[model samples]
Target: MKIGIEAQRIFRANKHGMDFVVLETIRELQKIDQKNEYYIFVSPGEDKCLEESKNFHIIEINCPTYPLWEQIAFPRIVSKVKLDLLHCTSNTAPLYCKVPLILTLHDIIFLEPKQNDNKSWYQNMGRFYRRIIVPRILPHCKKIITVSYFERNRIQQTLQLPEEQIIAIYNGYSKHFKKIKEPREITSKYIQAKEYLFFLGNTDPKKNTPRTLKAYSLYLKYSDKKLPLLIADLKEDIINDILRKQKIEEIKPYLFYPGYIPNKDLPYLYNGAFAFLYTSLRESFGIPMLEAMACGTPVITSNTSAMPEIAGEGGILITPTSEEEIANIILELEKNSNFYQQQVAYGLQRVQNFSWKNTAQSLLNLYRQTVTS
Candidate 1:
C-alpha cells in the first residue's frame, strides 16, 4: 500500500499537539509497515524530518496550512500525490480529495461557539473552517481517528459522524517518559529539586489557567504546608502576576522560566514533583496526566470528559470549574501520605493500557480496511 501522509505540522511546530501526533505515529508506522511505500507531504518552509528509507519518502508541497489554503491548495497536493490513501493528522484536511482520506480530529474546540470566546477576524475565519466546513465534509472521509473516546463522541455528536467511522486511538508517551533520576544539576537551578507541585500547559481559556491560579491561591491560603508551585511558560501575564502576588516566587537558587523542558527531562520533572496539577476544563485526552502517571507522579485532574477515563482508578479527579474542589483535592494529596502512595501505584497501572504501538496498529488496520472497501 502506498500511503501519502500530510506531515506539514511535524516540521513547523515548536510545541504543538498535532506535531507530536504526526511525528510519533509516522516513526512507529515506519517500523511496523516496512513493505508499504510511504510519502510524507510537508509545506514549503517545513523541512522533511524523516530519512529516506526502504519504503518512505518526503515530498515538500508548497501551501499554507490555514484559511483558504487548506481548503483550496491541500486537495491539489493530495491529488498530485496520487496515493492509495491520504491521512491528515490535523482537522484541516481538504474538503474534496480524489483519494480516500483519513483525518485525525484531535478536538472539536471550535465547533462549540461558546468556546471561541472573543477572537480576531483571522482566528474566527479558522474557526469557521473547523466549525462549518469540516463537519459538512466529515461524511466524505473514509475514516476518522480521535485521540480519546470523549473526542470520538464529540466529533460524532457535533458533526453527526457515524460512530463506527470514528476510531478512538489513545495518545501515547515518548519512550523517555518512564521514571528517571532527577537531574539535580539541571533541576536544582529551576525548582527545589522535589518540593513543588507542577502545572504545564498553555494559559488559554479552555485550559482553565485563571481558575488554576485561583485554586493555587486558595490552596496556599488554606493549606498549612508552604509548598511551592511550579508553572512553566504560561503566556498570560495576568495569571502570572496573580501567582507572583500570591508569593509563588522563583526557586531562589535557580533561574526561573524553565522554558520548554525537553522530552528526555519530562520524566525527571514528573517524578521529582510533589504532584502534577491538571485543571483543563475539557480534554479529549490529557497527555500530561498520562506522562505523570508513567512517571508514577500522583495526579490531580478534572472529573469531566476523558479525564476520568484516562485517570483510571488512579489520580485525584476534581471539579476543575470549582477552585474549592481543586484546593480540597490538593490539600488531601499533600496531607495524606498513604493516599498519595496509593494514587502513585494506581497511576502506574493505569498507564499500562496506552501504547503507541497499539495506536499505530489500530490506525494501520483501519487504513487497510479503508483501502479494501
Candidate 2:
C-alpha cells in the first residue's frame, strides 16, 4: 500500500508536541513496515526525518500551510501524489483530498470558548472551522485517529461522527526519556532545583498555567517548605510579562524560567524534580505525564481529560479550580516521603503500557485497510 502523510509539522523548525509526534510516528512506521511505501508531504520550509528509509520518500509541496494554501492548493497536491490514502496529523486537513483521508485531531481545546496567551481571535476562528467545516469534510474520510479516548469521544460528539471511525492511539514516551547518567557539572548548575516542582508545557489557558500558579501560591501559604517552582520557558513575550507580574517577592526566587530545555536535558529535569505538575485543562494525550512517569518521577495532574487514564493510580488528581486542594496534595507529597516513593513506583509501573511500535502498527493496518477496501 502507498500512503501519503501530511508531514508539514515534522521537526517544526523547533521542537514541540506536534513535531515530536510526527517524527516519532514516522520513524516507528519505518521500523514496523519495511514493505509499505510512504510519501511524506512536507511544506516548503519543512525538513524530512525519513531520509535514510528506502521505502519512505519525501514529496516537497512548496506551499504555505493555511487559509488559501490549504483550501485552494493542497487538494491538487494530494491528487498529484497518487496516494492510496492520506493521513493528516495536523488539524483542518484539505477540504477535499483526492484519496481516502485519516486525520489525527490531537485535542478540541481550540473548540472551547475560552482563550489564553492572547490567541482569542485565532482560537475562536478555529473553533468555528472545527464545528462548521470539519463535519462536511470528515465524512469523505475512511477513518479518524485521536491521541486518547477522551479526544475520540470529543471528536465524535462534536462532529456527530461514528464512534468506530475514531481510533484512540495512545501517546508513548520516548525511550530516551528514561533515567540517564546526569553529568555532575550539569547537576551542580541547577542546584536550586533540588526540591523544586517542575511544570512543563507552554503558559497558555489550555495548559491551565494560571490555575497551576494559583495552586503553587496556595502551597506556600500553609507549608513551611520552600521548594522552588520551576516553569519551562515560553516562546511568547507577553506570556513572560504575565509570568513576571505574578512573581511576588515571596515566590520570586523560587521561580526558575529556564528557556527551551533540550530533549536531552529533560530526563534529568524529570529525575531531579520533586514532583511533576501537569495542570492542563485538556490533552489529547498528556505526553509530559508519560515522560515524567517513565523517568520515575511522581506526578500531580488534573483528573480530567486523558490525565487519569495516563496517570493511572500513579499520580495525585486534583480539581483545576481548587487552588487550596492542589496545594494540599503538594504538601502531602512533600511531608510524607513514603507517599512520594509509592507514587514514583506506581508511575514507573503504569508507564510500561505505552509503546510507539504498537501505535505505528495499528496505524499501518488502518492505511492498508483504506487502500485494500
Candidate 3:
C-alpha cells in the first residue's frame, strides 16, 4: 500500500505535541514495516530530523501561508502521489483531497466551553481554520484517531460520530527520556539553584499559566523549602504579565525562565527537577506527564480531562482550577519523602505501558484495514 502522512510541521525548529507524535510514529513505522511505500509531507524547516529509508520518502511542500500550503499545495502533491490513504497527523486536513483520509484529532478543546479569556492572533486563526475544516472533513475521513479515550468520547458526542468511528490511540514519549546521569550540568545552565520545580508552559490559555503561578506563590508562602520554578517555552514578559495579573509578583525571585529547551535536553531537565508540574485545564493526552514519568521524575498534574487517565495512580492529581489544591500537593510532595518516592516508582512503572512502537503498530493496522475496506 502507498500511504501519505501529513506531517506539515515535523521539521520545524520549534515543535509541539502533534509534530512530535507524527515524527515518532513515522520513525517507528520505518522500523516495523518494510513492504508498504510511505510518503511524509512536510513544510520547509531548519531541522532535517527524519531520514528516508527504502520504503519511506520525505517530500517537502512549500507555500507562503498555512491555508494555501495545506489546501492548495498539499492536495496538488497528494493528487500526483495518488496514495491509497493519507493520514492527516494534525487536526485539520485538506478539505478536497481525493485520497481516503485518517485524521488524528488530538483534542476538541476549541469546541469546549470557554474557560479563559486568553487569545492570540495565531491561536485564533488556527482555531478558526479547525472550526471550518473539521466538520467538513469528518464525513470524508475513513477513520478518526484521537490521543485519549476521554477525547474520543468527547469527539464522538460533540461530532455525533459512532464510538467505532473514532478510536483512541495514546501518545508515547521518546525512548531518550530517561534518568540523566549528570543532571547538574544541564540544570546549572538554566538556573542557579540545584533543585527546582519544572513546568512547560506557553501563551496557550488551556495551559492555566496564571493559575499555576498563583499556586506556586501559595506554595512559597506556606512551605519553608521554597523551591524555585523553571518554566520552559514561555517568554519573560509573558511570565511577568501573568505574575502581575495574578498578584503574585513577589514570587518572581523564585521563578526562572529557561527560554526554550531542545527535545534532546528535556530528559535531563526532568531528571534534575524536584517535581514536574502540569496543571492544564483540559488536555486530550498529557504527553509531558509521561515524559517526566519516563525520566523517573514525580509529576503533579490535574484531575480533569485525560490527566488522571494518563497519569493513573502514578502522579499527584489536583484540581486545576484551585490554586490551593495545587499548592497543597506541592507541600505534600516536598514534606513527605515516602509519598514522593512512591509517585516516582509508580511513574517509572507506568511509562513502560506506552511506546511509539506500539502506537505505530496500531496505526499500521488501521491503515491496512482502511485501505482494504
Write candidate 1's Cα lDDT for 164-270 as tens digits.
89988888876777776654555576686456778875534577766777777778777786567776755445445646754554322222346566555667778
Candidate 2 per-residue lDDT over residues 223-337, each given as its tens digit: 7876887777554454455557766345555667666776767788888888899887877788888898888888899988888877776468998778788889999998899
The window of 10 residues in a row where model 2 has the poorest summed lDDT is: 183-192
Which regions of candidate 1 deviate over 4 angstroms? 44-49, 115-125, 236-260
Counting clashing residue pairs in each candidate, in order, gives 1, 0, 0
Model 1 global lDDT (CA atoms, 0 to 1): 0.75
TM-score for each candidate, following the candidate numbering? 0.89, 0.90, 0.98
Taking the tens digit of each residue's C-alpha lDDT, what string does model 3 give over 1-373? 9999999998899888888999999999999999999999999999999999999999999998999999999999999998999999999999999899999999888777667666578987888888888889998888999999999989999889977888999889899998878888877888888889999998888899899999999999899889999999899899888887888888998889978898988988999998999999988898899899988889999999899999996568899999999999999999999999999899999999999999999999999999998
Note the residue pairs that clash in candidate 2: none
Deviation in Å, model 2, residue 210 alpha carbon? 1.2
TM-score-wise, the better of 1 and 2 is 2
Q: Of models 1 and 3, which has the larger TM-score? A: 3
How accurate locally, in lDDT, is each candidate?
0.75, 0.76, 0.91
Consecutive 10-residue window with the lowest summed lDDT within model 3? 111-120
Worst 10 residues of 1 by lDDT: 248-257
Best by TM-score: 3
